[model samples]
Target: MTKYRPSKNSDGFTIIELLIVIAVAAVFGALTAGMLANATDIYSDSLERQKFISEVRSSFFKIIREATWQKSYTSFAGSNNKKLNIYSTDGKSIDYEIRNNNDIIQNNDQVSGSNNEILTDKIEYSSSNVYYLDQQGTGIDIVSQIENVRSLKLDFQFSNDTDDLRLQSHTLPYNLRIGRAMSYHE
Candidate 1:
């Protein structure tokens, strides 16, 4: 009968090796979980910022479009401060004031006789020429006093017909370009 000798090395992993492998796996799992959590947070923040910017832009354009269609009031005084004192539909009260300072103040007292409250502040514009609602419904923020503006541009389109040309002669631009560059952090 031939005698069989046992090998020095074990066929399977020892207890220590198994423990070490489990520890390494646990570490890797923890790191992966942390990275995933961080990524989720960043994505959520980006989405929120995007939504905020969209709301701001939408509100701004809506105001501009309305102002463009309405008749400008030239008889009112103290309205030349590169700010628009937009009155409510009732005509008895001011709704909000869009100022060249990039502030949107709501006149709470228009009908209630309350003072104006700032709805938004620190608005940054891309154009150096800040457009505000003048007292007369005119866009008159044409001075270079506005600082930190990244860009400013003006465009005018003329009518093709002679009758329309007369109307266009006295009219300001129907469209305005406003842009700004700034970083917003939340």
Candidate 2:
């Protein structure tokens, strides 16, 4: 084997080559930064949406569960029509109300501690969120005639700043349907 020697013209690096490499690296860095920023924004939006949905859904289910065997129900008057009072046969009363124009709160007077809970801060401030329904599913004015109300429909609009979600739920008292038993999902 012959001994190999390096070429005399082979220098370490040229200024132009160094500058070109730096420019390419900078371009790649900038692109990576932009993609990272976009990903962060997407993650933030998704988290917010999930939190909003969780809050609203949990609150809704809590109300449904508590009122499943309600003996009587009433609504607040005037601008608080959306607020409700549910009473059980055991005299336990639970009140659901909107406070500060956005937050949905639950007050269980029967409980001594932890009686008050902030359900969500995404509910739209409106008096029409709760609708009292008759046996025929017709909406009724609770303030005027609440005696005929057999069920309730919750029509809430929740927001996460980036998007808005509307949820409508109609709850029929399961126990009240005595002989007309139906599946849980039905």
Candidate 3:
């Protein structure tokens, strides 16, 4: 009654065990693939969003900088919210407006024919209301006259398929003056 012998089938794993192991491995592999795909999609979307934001910021910076140096502001062609005329110190004028409701056009040399520069194409819809700030920082509409304009406010929006970004800049014009009397010492 003291016999020790190993079974013949113990040399390798059974077919059922092999099948179970393969099925488990396949499930894990599929899960990993799915997660990778999801991460890739998220990364792609994030990149697109970042690019859009960068472009918008760049456009705004250029617009604000130009507006800061504007010596004159006027409405364009009897249109208040649709267009603007900004004059620099060198007597050159530029127009800022939305063309066809989608393009941010900056027309340099408004006295000439069509020198439009596209600032950004992401403008789905935009409208600008230029308010002239008084000495007390009150916003007053400059409908047909532009005098004593201390600052100008430009509010606009940019949009893509799934997102919208709104931006505003209140720029002090370079030609603002208070006309104070200077005291002289004898």
Candidate 4:
């Protein structure tokens, strides 16, 4: 009987070589997955910041408009200048309030008993300054002196978890911009 020997060159890969290839591929796959996850988180954070700014800007403009246009207010009271009840003769009323100690600001327009409102829970309330006009159109914010005054200014400080913005507003006059000179001349 004679023993046969096999050649050194083989047509297929060795078991050791196949195992190494699979291990390298798995490491690359894991790295790619991690990168993708990080990119997704960055995108989400940017979107949230954008939304926060938009809502803050829009609400600020609306509040300024109300301060300039509305001729009367039913009440103004609260710590750090929060809460305003607008005066309306049309049997409906609108109320603006900052709730929960620097957390949120809300606008509630009540037709009868229900509240129609728009609010954002993300705005961080810092502080607000309320100013009013007397019969002579002087600015005041004292509660004791409110009966003889008109609203003249609204200084609002709004914030998100990431940033802070201060919006200072001044109305034209106590008469609500009625019948004023159109041009200034030398």
Q: What lDDT score is found at residue 100 in candidate 4?
A: 57
* Winner of 2 and 3 under lDDT: 2
The stretch of ten residues in a row with the least summed lDDT in candidate 3 is 177-186
TM-score head-to-head 1 vs 4, winner: 4
Deviation (Å) of 10 in candidate 3: 6.0
The residue pairs in collision within model 2 are: none
For model 2, the stretches where C-alpha displacement exceeds 4 angstroms are: 1-15, 72-80, 179-186
- Local accuracy by lDDT, each model: 0.42, 0.72, 0.70, 0.60
On residues 1-186, what C-alpha lDDT tens digit does candidate 2 reach at each position?
A: 999997789658889999999999999999999999999999998897888788778877787677576654332233135677776667677788877569888888778764668878787876337777777989888777765677777777777677777777888755444433245623
Cα misplacement distance, residue 163 of candidate 1 (Å): 47
lDDT of 3 by residue, 20-135 (tens): 99999999999999999999999999999999999989987777777765654442223245466677767787777766658788888745775777888887563444455656
TM-scores, one per candidate: 0.47, 0.75, 0.75, 0.57
Worst 10 residues of 4 by lDDT: 71-80
lDDT measured at residue 176 in model 2 versus the true structure, 0 to 100: 46
What tens digits encode model 4's per-residue C-alpha lDDT throughout 37-142?
9999999988987887888778766666655544333244331255655544343445666665654454445455445355555444556655676657677664
TM-score of 3: 0.75
Better TM-score candidate (1, 2) = 2
Sorted by lDDT, highest first, which candidate order results?
2, 3, 4, 1
